[model samples]
Target: MLSIIVAVAENNVIGKDNGLIWKLPRDMKHFKETTTGHYIIMGRKTFESNGRPLPNRTNVIITRDKNYKAEGCVIVHSLEDAIKEAKNDSEAFIIGGGVIYDLSMPLVDRIYLTKIRHTFEGDTLFPELNMDNWNITEKRDFEPDEKNEYPFTILTLDKKK
Candidate 1:
């Protein structure tokens, strides 16, 4: 299964200055817990933002740069190629930087969205999802704590059959 995982603010903003705008530790934990041991397909910029390939999972970077090379990462020229690289996995995740999200939105079977209950100033935004095409299969709400900066909700949405 191909899944898109993201954290967006109330205003749909996901990042600014090529990095995440907020620090939500719980959300980070959730992302790690869910995506661990799976193939993580992401855009080149997203990989750069993260600085390196995450351990324990296969890292597939999608980039237009034919000569692009990231040690320990499988580099592909397109999102389709990235998907193809991760085809054997039971579940592969598309970890985005806006463009990759947009490209994979229609092709993914599921979405794991973290809805942060605050607005942010950002250049990158999550695409508006049409509720009609999805069904909420699971949801968990969390309140802000000393470790986490904002209140948020984690939702697992499956494409409608």
Candidate 2:
């Protein structure tokens, strides 16, 4: 199975200047827990923004640059190649920058989304999802806490049968 994991602001913002706009600890924790031990595929910019490979996960990077290389990651020139490399894993995660998210959205089986209640000014935004195509399999709402600035909801959506 292939899944997409992302946090988006009310305005659909996901990042600004190649970095995430929010610092929600719970969301971060959820991300780590969900993706651990899975094969994670990301675009070159997303991989660079993360600085290094995530521990305990197979990191696959999609980049147009044929010569690009990261010490702890498998670099591929296309999304198809990335998916092919992760085909043997029980589950593979699409962890993104906006472009990557947009490209992989149609191909993924599930989406793990953290929906923040506040709007943010950002250079990058998540693609608009056609909700009719997805069914919410799980949902949890959280109030703002000291460690998290805004109220948010964690939603697990599966492509509708």
Candidate 3:
């Protein structure tokens, strides 16, 4: 299965200045737990923002430029390459910046979304999802915590086959 994982603010903002706008620990844990041991594919911008490979997962970065290279990451010039690399695995996670997310959405089998309750001003946004094409298979709401500024929910959607 191809799973696309993304965290969005209430207004659908995914990032600011090519980096995440919020630092929610629980959300971080959720991402780590769900994507561990699977391939994590992202765009070059997102990979650069992270500064290093996420542990225990195959890191794949999509870039249009052929010369880009980073330690411990498999760089590809296209989505086709990313998909080809991920085919050996049972599932792979597309963890992204806007460009990669937009390109991969149609090819993914499932979507793992962290929906934050509050909106923030941001420069980047998640792609618009077509609810008619997806079925929500799982959803769990998280209550506000002392450290978390906003409540959030984990939403898993499977594409209608």
Q: List candidate 1 segments past 4 Å from native.
A: none
lDDT of 2 by residue, 66-154 (tens): 89989989999989999999999998999998889999999999999999999999999899999999999999999998898899999
TM-score of 1: 0.99
Best candidate according to TM-score: 1
Q: Judged by lDDT, which candidate is best?
A: 1
Tell me the TM-score of each prediction against the true structure: 0.99, 0.98, 0.97
Global Cα lDDT for candidate 1: 0.95
Task: Point out the higher-scoring one by lDDT: 1 or 2.
Answer: 1
lDDT of each residue in 44-132, candidate 1, tens digit only: 98999999999999999998889999999999999888899898999999999899999999999999999999999999999999999
Instruction: Evaluate residue 86 in candidate 1 and report its C-alpha lDDT on the 0 to 100 scale.
Output: 91
Ranking by TM-score: 1, 2, 3
